[model samples]
Target: MRKFWQKNRKTSLAFLVAALLIAILWFFFWPLNRVVEAPGEAVNIQPMVKIQGKQPLKQNEFMITAVSIAPARPVSYVHRLFDPHIDIQKTNDVTGGQNNADFNNVQKVYMQSAINNAITVGFQHANRPVTKQYHGVYILNVFPQSDFKNRLRPADLIESINGQQLTKSTEYVNYIKSLPKNAPLKIMFKRDGRQMMVSGHKHDIVKGFNGIGITMIDDMTIKTDPKAHIDPGQIGGPSGGLMFALQVYSQLTQQRYQLKKIAGTGTITSDGQVGEIGGVDKKIIAAHKSGAQVFFCPYVKPTKTNLALEPGHQTNYQVAKATAKKYAPGMKVVPVTSFDQALNYLKTHQ
Candidate 1:
């Protein structure tokens, strides 16, 4: 064995080095069935939201926080092992069994809904006229077995079915239910601002009901008096809802954000409620890094019933507070269950 080692030592060393390089490459480049969610940037909301014919309020800054999500490599797991704020989620779970493109499409739809809700809430609070403008039903997901699976996409807008106009998701559902099983469907839809048409047959989405194998929601917009333009640009998610609403309200009411740099993440409903969002811990880290003085997090008062539903659960505010304590001790985290609560905090705390 010693003689053999002496004779083949150089070749053995070369082979070992090659193997090590391969393992490093695999760890670096190979994709996993997971994704890493980490701290993203805190974007200023002023420039992103513009209220026409209204003077923009000269406040410090109301910012929206984001969470960076990426497909996990083996090296990402190593990073997660070191970073407590980073989380690993299954790709299927994150995308809801859809491809990345479909996932992004759904996110864009959510963002649009958030913007509409924000406008409605802000206008109502400001005593401004705001009316709902329904365009059609938005396609959220397309099943693989559907006849239009290859032709339709998640972000497409279904304007009509069988020459009948569609203004709401319920209208689409009811119209589909009126048709026979496997009935031919002539769908008029819009994609990327261009009108398109597709011919397909309905499938049994439910056990007995026959319909297009697609999940959808109403495509509606809030037309506010004096107009408010919100261009989310590449930021696609409902997380910006609260901050957007805040910005809108601040401008309309001429009330400034008391804090120098305020950052937050929460979904805003049409009723002016601030709903809980994902990645509160990472959002706190991002807000702190952006020099934000305060961060508003969605909080739900834990009750016996809620606690019983989940064995061990912490609210977003709780997670944000803990994350701030450990990583961003200087930043202040405020718990708010609704838009009024958040506005009240800014009013009283300052």
Candidate 2:
């Protein structure tokens, strides 16, 4: 028995080493199903995006704010569980598709979002008549387990869904909302500049509701003023839309004034509507820290809030207002549903 034990010692040692390596990989290196988010710093937009060609009048700096979010690993997720400010979300929830976390692809989408917001806001706020020429809808991210999984790519353009051409994101959403459950849907998309067609079963997304699981936005050309350019450097996302428009308007129309330094976040369209954005609480803290005198946040009624919960749930104005009081007592957090409202407030206040 002693001779047998000695003979197998090396084998047992090898097995133990292998098991340890597996445990270490699982604990530290393997990807988990969750991600962590903490309060990000508020970034000033005045210098990040540059407006070229035709410099209007001069005024005090009007800044925009962004929350600094960092993705966490599984080990960090456990630590975040005890942190009140840190948020945990599924990896799929944040990335959508299996490969959505490809830093380059994500950066492309973010830059595109920022560009769209900058252009649309610039044209609209400049009081220039803007025309939207829609080509298709740009696929931002395909949700995990989606029917289009393994078929559609991130940059694919969905030209039409179910034989209906899409010009706006609202149209695609409304059309999907009107579809019958379990119906087969046809999607015509352009990949690598080539058109392709595919059919898929719909997904029962969110409490028995049937629709395609994808995140996308309209691909439209905003033709109004080509001379106005907004360079957002590497910063991405649509959250800076409102602030971009405000700053662009100040430059385009030459409405130079010594207005108080302002900070805002929202998705702005070519029609002058200010859509809601995420991270209002963190953004308010950022704005206050940046010494912004006014913060323009989106306003959505309770009814609207309930409808777009997944896109975003919290009422930005309410959260921003509350956060401002706690973090920045002297700052004014204003609610705005449209650019008109913000402009009016600026007129009155400035």
Candidate 3:
């Protein structure tokens, strides 16, 4: 028996080595490719909200159907394998597969910077939201056809509209909408450290509605203590702005949003409501994976189906839906109209 066992040892060892190699290759390469090459699609969900007028006698308006999402780019399998921060093998075991955290973090930084540049350039040319002082907001770049050109830029803090003080995005939107059709409106904003004013006539894109073809974003202040160093690249778009603001506000003041157990994603305006974000589905997946129960989506919806459609929007929606359906089917996806709604949801759920 001993002689027979010794004789077959070499053959058994060779088979074991071959099996191990195959297993290692399948675990690392095969699953990595699947995660990186996953196909995504776009989706649009409309939100409903009621806007109250500043004056008692003025009639209130209901806002419906104004949000959209699409995929921007796909994360490749090679990218996930090379990620430095997260253990890709562990993630694959948990989610069937996942993107590498290092790759995602870098990509987020680039995307954030690009969006900021686009908004800056767009506001610089439109000549609206123009301020003489260089408040933090800088005009990055402008799209030729977008109505928002030269209206507002990155880092600019809107101080007021007309004579009214602007405290939130809803206030700014309502102020613009309340103007007399085609009437020249006064916009006051801070640039650098000084205050400046710009004038423009509101254009009516849809009948009975007035608008300036500008999209504005607030420049958020990054917080870091003496012991902690943060990378600027970590700053992304205004989508997480509201959550960051709430977190910051909670830290500074005693007012708690009860957000420790809750994770939310959305753009924030000054008025404190969560605005619709671009990568709702991706953000939702991230939130869910992070152990968050309630997901907040921006209340804004797309106006025209085909016109606002972009490649990124299409991809984001597709991946988001598929990921949600597969992972957190019972999780609540809450649509937020404003910061108030988000805060309320958090408080109630907590």
Candidate 4:
């Protein structure tokens, strides 16, 4: 036994020395090597999207786009890896408690819920993608003719236009564009579960005309949830809530917001303001790593209070300022005080 132990002693010593060397190399040289060869390129270059030569947006021209809304969930594996410090739970909490009534908060929860409900129904019935969510840009604040007055309102779920079942807003716009001058068209919508139909005559203009006097903004909604339990009182306004809601809705409908290929952040209100979101710097870093080109910022007043206290207001401003300085330097930090701003922006931009 003594002879056996003596023979293994050298082997054990060699093993110990190798382990120590490996530890030292890992502690110093390995980390230094990683620092030298960082995972991604330091300088980020975005593709140039040109808005030149596009026709100037007209006030009476209605622009519409499809949006999806659904449940807010955990970030994907890629997002987590890029921003390991992201508090998804906190984000969810904030979204869940968002308020739609507040113009400043931008009614994200309500919109998300609307989209979720719609997607669930559409998926259960059609098993096809019903909408293509995109940012729109158009003119804001033009009233429709008296004949069309009170026929539409913000948050009204448009079911169809001109006998064409409208799955997306773009489809509706295209349908309207196809109609001839003085052609009578019927629009069907669902509001509070009551279906209503209205009729309007398409108009002709020199620039390939369509519908009369009605100026439409981009309309986005979250499908409504019939089963998932949510407290009515908990939801409050947060600027990026709309984008988050849409992402969730797209997931629930199995439509995939481009197979989760896209990532963005913005604040949504019930009234449709895309306000600036907090944690811009961290979110930008995370989004850039996740390959997000579009980032949505809610147009919120810097003085808005989260807790009716000075500390909360200060913190909100600090986060907003930091975000502006870090992630979206050249990007337009759209300041939307109402849904009209968001809708108009989407119309002209899209």
Candidate 5:
């Protein structure tokens, strides 16, 4: 009876070990339907922006901040539980039902658009000649009812509709609107640098008007007197718009505003408007960790419509200020409503 009891005890221990190992594996490997947002790196923008027939800025003061986004697994939950700074969000909310590859492609498009907008703003501010050249309509989103749903995706540049070769998205939409309902359509588009064609029929996407069941925006380039090249590496998103514009303006005008390490986050418009962006707290933390002395964030009065949409909403500057105060009290947080504001701030501080 003693030997039998000892054998049973050994078997029980073996079973317990196996169960423990399985639990550990599940805890680490199982995928979750969430994503983690953490503070990313702050990169100097001077080297990334190169202008022809001009000397590169010697000082690196402007920095572009990014937030690291990753799919959450079981391990990510553990990390988020322990780290208060990390944020967890629904994957659908972050990606808008896009897979990882599709979401990344959309981000790349946003980054390109931001660069072009920044170039336009910077060149105009520097008193340099800049011309806007419209390319084609860039597809941003496709609806489920669209016949080209599976064939077309975001980041695809629709070069023409019905072989009309429209340069502006508005023109494409107008042309489609004039067409008869359920009219057969031919779309010539470019994806991954390869020109592709799709045939479909326009549907009643709005007010009884026919549309391709896809949303599009204009794709264009800002041709400047001094050609500019921006190489952002793997960094994607429009959060770097303000910093890109600042760097471009500084290089073109040769203004030495590198008195201190300046880091910022905001999206730039062609007319120099600095739009608010997401992940302000994460960006501030990143800037602080990178030794930024001054941080610029978007701050503007809320429009009546915006206030109605989101009550008690905090502006990016407000969030950035609080984060900087808590994590890096030595850092100064400056509010900017437009690119000119940020530029003037640098000029006056210098």
Candidate 6:
């Protein structure tokens, strides 16, 4: 009987050991279905652009930062859920497909578009002529929560709003903004090879962005400027448009002007309009880490997450404003709706 009892005890111990080993392997090696986003490094934008027949002012450093996201292991995903600074989304929601290379190529294409628009807008702000033609505003993206998500899509050309001719993006924006909240807008657009009219009421897509919820660029021509040139090597995306325009504007207008180190992110339209961007939370942290004295953020639009997540005044500026206070109390966060507003702020504040 004693021998039999000892044998049973050893058998139970072996089973426990095998179970422990299996649990350990699963804990560290299992793949997750989500992607995580966190702060990415910040970079200076002044060095990115090269002007022809002119030396850009070296007085200030203009920078833009990005957020990095990646697929997570089971353990990492579970851990990130509790981290306030880390953001997560379903892989499908973020990547859309398994082909990362294709997505990167798309980003490069968008970056080139940003550079083109920035060059035109920056030169225009400097009062340098580069033939501005009003063809129609181009939609770059349509978020799922936007009121226009069902009616409009990316690459759609905006021809008119409420029977009024749409020239610049600002015209369309002002017309919609002039109405009360959730007002219906009559929009004329061309998609694919056909012209279509869509009527939709703008909702609180974001708390402050009560108009159409589409990211846009101009569909007009921007003849390259003779006096200045921009060469942004390897770096890709529309977020740097605002800073690129500022760099060009500051260099051309001011002679021997010293600038305080400022960083920002936004898109620039051909007419010197500033548009909103993603990753405002991560960017604020990166700019502060890079020792930026002041950070300029877009005040153009807002998101449903920003509106619902943040109760009051939800815009890119509001996110940057809150981020600056929380992460870098020493850094000043300023918001701008146009290139001139950003320029004037720098001139007066310093």
lDDT scores for all predictions?
0.86, 0.71, 0.43, 0.41, 0.86, 0.75
Per-residue alpha-carbon lDDT of candidate 5 for residues 279-303, written as tens digits (9 for 90 to 100) = 9899999889999989999887666
Model 5 alpha-carbon miss at residue 29, Å: 2.8
Question: Residue 188 of model 6: what lDDT?
Answer: 92
Error of model 3, residue 191, in angstroms: 15
Q: Which regions of candidate 4 fall more than 4 Å away from where they truly are?
A: 1-110, 113-142, 145-147, 204-209, 212-238, 242-319, 322-350
Every model's Cα RMSD, please? 3.7, 5.9, 16.2, 20.8, 2.5, 7.8
Clashes of each: 0, 1, 57, 54, 0, 0
Looking at model 2, report the run of 10 residues with the lowest lDDT sum: 95-104
Residue-pair clashes, model 2: 1
- Model 3 misplaced stretches (Cα beyond 4 Å): 1-137, 144-233, 255-259, 301-323
User: In terms of lDDT, which candidate is stronger, 2 or 6?
Assistant: 6
Measured by TM-score, how close is model 4 to the native structure?
0.32
TM-score of each: 0.83, 0.71, 0.39, 0.32, 0.90, 0.65
- What lDDT would candidate 4 get against the real structure? 0.41
Who wins the TM-score comparison? 5
TM-score for predicted model 6 compared with the true structure = 0.65
lDDT of 4 at 128: 35
- Backbone steric clashes in candidate 6, count: 0
Clashing pairs in 6: none
Query: Candidate 2 local accuracy as lDDT?
Result: 0.71
- Deviation in Å, model 1, residue 162 alpha carbon: 3.9
User: Which pairs in model 1 have colliding backbones?
Assistant: none
lDDT of 6 by residue, 1-350 (tens): 99999999999999999999988888878667877788786788777777665676677888878888877666776677676678777777665442465356446646767777888877777777776576777776666767777577656788988888877777777777798988888889987679999888878777667766776665655665555555667666788888888887776665333455788888877677888877898889888889888888888456665576542447788778888888889988888888888888887766
In terms of lDDT, the poorest run of 10 residues in model 3 is: 42-51
lDDT per residue for candidate 3 within 39-75, as digits (tens), equals 1221111011111211211111111111121121223
The residue ranges of model 1 lying beyond 4 angstroms of the native Cα positions read 1-13, 53-58, 142-152, 173-186, 192-213, 301-312
Tell me the lDDT of candidate 3. Answer: 0.43
